[model samples]
Target: MKAPDFDYLRPETLAEAMDMLSRHGEDGAIIAGGQSLLPLLNFRLAGPERLIDIGRLAALKQIVDGDGFVEIGALVRHCDLASSEAVARAFPLLRQAVGHIAHPAVRHRGTIGGSLAMADPAAELGACCLALEAEMSLQSVRGQRWVRAVDFFAGIYETALAPDEILTAVRLPRRGPDSVQIFSEVARRRGDFAIAGLALVADNHMANPRLALLGVADRPILAEKTMALLANNMAAADQAIELIGNEIDPAEDPAYPPAYRRQLVRTLLRRTLMELLP
Candidate 1:
């Protein structure tokens, strides 16, 4: 189905985009790469009076390397991240995960910020950002604020992004000297949504372990208990798996039920520990 009648706009600057969004308020919807929003619009799931396009804003397209993090612009595409030397150096696991998001065509058109803002449960970037403890920059006409990845995601298809706010950039932590990262998923097809996915980032000695689990809940969830177990003692892998199996609250689907997904999660967790732990 075609999208309903709506006003289309392309703002030249971030300020202009903010002004348009503020003016339209609830009637406006932000569009960057249009990878996520266009499908929603086509399905009639989202109908807005104004479409604020910020794809032309050059400032939002920049990638800056900071002392401890890479300041990745919100408008950066998935394919761009996959090929970016900066991204590879800072977050190689993220670069690998980006390659698994949908297909090459989708990656070419999908913006990193758009995927994060959409907060899809099975999205690889959000889980990777969480595992990497990335920071998101939220801007508005009022002011700007930074939100941690752990707090930015609210629920499935939801985030801390306000009606008048825009996600400007993401601050991804640079890989440390002893950093070890891994991403794995069980998808029916090579480019399909993951049935169960996980992203893990930690040091060689299991210090500061960060594990993010996806496709088993309403949001991409940080496995705090499991991470704690890994941090305290990697030998408690079985116990941690049991804890996650009990904690999982996946939506009931006839084909892939909660039990199956939880089992997948357990398997993935075990495999991750086995491969990474010395």
Candidate 2:
């Protein structure tokens, strides 16, 4: 299917893109790599009157290391993140998660900000962001604001972003020396959307770990209680599984039934915890 008629604008500057978005409001959609939006447009699931393409905005395509955080521009592609030495060194969870997203071709065109903004429940980036405790930099003609990952995703395909706002960057806190990271997911076939996935980042000594699950809920589900359970008694893996199953309300989908998904969560949680072992 071909996309409906729409006006396209490739703005060279961030201000220009913001102006176009403000003018078009809900009728306009932001296109980064077009990896996700183009398919939605072709399927007629999204019909926008205007498209604000920020793919050419070089200012939005950088990855920089801050004192305590790593900043990734919204336009940074998955392939870039996967290959980045800085990302590999400081954000192993993100690098590992990006390596599993779709495939090489898709990674070349998929942007980190686009995936998070889309808020797909089965996306690795969303789950990684939650586990990393990342923050997003949002901008609009009005002003700019930062949103924590915990507060950014409202539901599946839903976010805190307004129609005229754009996500410009994502900030991930650098893992400390004692941090251990793990990421695992199961799909029907390689490169397919996950049936279930898990990402875990913990400082065992500090007893603060972030446990997040995907493909088991409407949005990426942050399992604070499950993390606490694991931290308290890493020996009792069954307790972690039971806590996750009882806490997360997974949806029934064609890929897997709700019961199967709950079981997957348990299995993945156990495996991830095992990976955290010294």
Candidate 3:
């Protein structure tokens, strides 16, 4: 089905986009790469009265290295992240996650901000951001604010973003020494939405690890309990699987049953931990 009729505005600057979003309120939606939103529009799942396209807003398209973090413009595409040497060095998990997003063509057109804003529970980007403990930069006519990844995702296809707020950037902490990262997922086919996924990051010296699970919950979720288990026995693979299956709530869908998903999560979590351990 074709999308419903709607007015379109391509803003050249952040100020212009915010102004348009403020005026339109919930009737408007921002379009970055249009990879996700366009499909929703075409299916009539989303029929915003106005589309404020910020794909050309240069201010929201930059990737800057900071003292302790990297600020990535929301409009940066998956392909950009995959090939960026800076991103690769600072956050290899992000690079790995983006490469698994969909396909080369989709990665070329799908923006990091778009994927996060879409908030698909099965998307690798969402899981990676949570695993990295990234922060989201949100803007509105009133002002700007930052929301941590743990707080950004509310539920399935839901986010903490206000109707008038546009996600402007993602801030990721710089990698520390002895940091090991792993990302793995099980999809029915290459580039398909994952049936189960896991992203893990550990700093052996710090003795802290972040475990994030996807495609098994209402939203991408950080497995704090699993992480706690890792602190005790970084080599206890079975413990990691048990914690993930017992603590995390797996979603049941036509694609997979809850029991099956739990088992897949166990398998993926084991795989992720093995890759992250020495």
Candidate 4:
């Protein structure tokens, strides 16, 4: 099915785009790469009155390296992130996770901002964002504010973004020299949505770990109980693995049941800990 008719407004600048969004409010939908929105539009899942196109706004396409974090502009394509040497050095897990986002064609067109805004429960980037403890830059005609990755995701296909606000960029903290990143997912096939995926970032000894899992809950979620266990003592692998079931609330699905997902999470946690801890 084709998308419903909508007025298309292309803003020449980021400010103009925000202003348009502010005026239209709930009636408007922002379109950058359109990789995520177009599908919804085509399926008639979303029927906004206006399409505020920010695809040509050059300001939101830059990847800036900062003192302690890398500010990746919202419009940066997945392909760009997958190929970036800077991203590889600063956040290798993100670089690895980018490889799991659809195929090259989709990666070439899909934007990081689009992925984060879509907030798909099974998407790799959202899980990576949580593991990296990234911050999202939200801007509107009113003002700008930063939301941590943990607080940004509200639920399935939902976010903390106000209708008038746009996610301009993401601030991903650089991993320390002693840090290790582990990313693995169980997918039916390559490029398919993950049945269960884990993104774990921690030190060599598994201290101060940040573990986020996808396809096991309503949103990419942090395994808080498991992390707390590891932080308290590095030798709590067996107990931490058991806590995975408590931390995540995976919905029952015909294809991937909650039990299967819980087991996958346990397997991933156990396997990664073996490699990292000893």
Count of steric clashes across candidates, in order: 0, 0, 0, 0
Candidate 3 wrong stretches, greater than 4 Å: 276-278
TM-score: model 4 vs. ground truth: 0.96
The residue pairs found clashing in candidate 1 are: none
> How well is each residue in 181-264 modelled by candidate 4, as lDDT tens digits?
989888888999899999999866777898999988889999888888888476788889888866777887997788888899
Worst 10 residues of 2 by lDDT: 202-211
- Give candidate 4 misplaced runs (Cα > 4 Å): none
Model 1: per-residue Cα lDDT over 85-152, one tens digit each: 98887788988798789888988889999999999999888899999989999999988999999899
lDDT of every model, 2 decimals: 0.88, 0.88, 0.87, 0.90
Cα lDDT of model 4 overall?
Answer: 0.90
Supply candidate 1's per-residue lDDT for 268.
87
lDDT of 3: 0.87
Per-residue CA lDDT of candidate 2, range 1-278, in tens? Answer: 99989998889899999988898878889999988899999999999988888898999899998899999999999999998888888888888888788889999999999999999989999999999999999999999999999899999899999998999999998878878888999998888889889998887552677888998888998888887777756776777778887777776678577888888888888787766567
RMSD of 1: 1.4
The TM-score measured for candidate 3 stands at 0.96
Q: After superposition, how far is residue 76 of candidate 4 from its true place, in Å?
A: 0.7
Every model's TM-score: 0.96, 0.96, 0.96, 0.96
| Residue pairs whose backbone atoms clash in candidate 2 | none
Error of 3 at 62 (Å): 1.0
